[model samples]
Target: MSFVPIICGKRDWDVEYAQSQEYNAIYCPNCHNYKVRPVKRREFITIWFIPVMPFFWGKQLVCPICNWRQDFKSDEQLKKVLREQDNIRAGKVGG
Candidate 1:
């Protein structure tokens, strides 16, 4: 007789707002790729490739090009990021 143990867990992210042109054009600090996107962070505990529990849901700005993530501590922080993107689109600042 033999027994095997398997452990699995993963973090998931969903695109909450991806309509900002400036956000898409922004360059990633890690990869220097112009593919930064807005995403909401979600973590889950999985058993046998199935999500069993979800936790730590929050807003974030991510660079899909290099898998970089900037988590938001509060709603104000998320709003600030959005405002920054808008400012970039408006040419008020460099993206």
Candidate 2:
């Protein structure tokens, strides 16, 4: 699949990221239910000089047939956006 990056957190942008992927079930201890736990998948990548370049991609699984979900952004997409932004800022291309 083609990757695309998007911002997620509001005030949590003061950190760095690494290229990676993750998968697991989201178990809720408060509910004490197994099915209440859904699956989760994600990816992330970091850039050297920009906090805005941190890309995160993922999707939370609820049900297969239901199509209820939360999707995340990929690192490649983030890198691309940052690169494009940098290029534009540098006057390397047209607006």
Candidate 3:
């Protein structure tokens, strides 16, 4: 498989062009069930802090279909998603 490029600091190329893959998501927002997502050009850019010492930052995606929605980060989104289930442990952010 080809490598999916991930960057930090600044990117030279336009983000739109760099994203070779189309990320698709259909949310039954009413039912709270989201459809399987397509392969996204993923990256981890950080800007916040909230304990756990090692859990911040995430997947950044430009939604293909719902281009209307805000571009969401994978890390922040996942944190909000899996706030509970304490027993599990993981390395710090950027690990």
The Cα local distance difference test for each model comes to 0.71, 0.40, 0.33
lDDT of candidate model 3 versus the reference:
0.33
- Regions of model 2 farther than 4 Å from truth: 1-72
lDDT of 1 at 34: 67
User: Ranking under TM-score, best-scoring first?
Assistant: 1, 2, 3
Q: lDDT, candidate 1, residue 18?
A: 42
> Per-residue CA lDDT of candidate 2, range 1-95, in tens?
89776544422221223423222223223443323213344333433433443344443334334344443356465445446645765789875
Superior by TM-score: candidate 2 or candidate 3: 2
Best by lDDT: 1
Compared with the true structure, the alpha-carbon lDDT of candidate 1 equals 0.71
What is the per-residue lDDT of model 1 for residues 1-95, given as tens digits with 9 covering 90 to 100? 99888878785758566475544565567887667777767788888778888877877778766788887676577667767756875899753
Candidate 3 or 1, higher TM-score = 1
RMSD of 1: 4.0
Candidate number with the higher TM-score (1 or 2): 1
User: What are the root-mean-square deviations of the candidates from the true structure over C-alphas?
Assistant: 4.0, 21.9, 17.5
Off by over 4 Å in 3: 1-59, 73-76, 81-95
Steric clash pairs (candidate 3) = 54-92, 54-93, 58-75, 59-74
TM-score of 1: 0.62
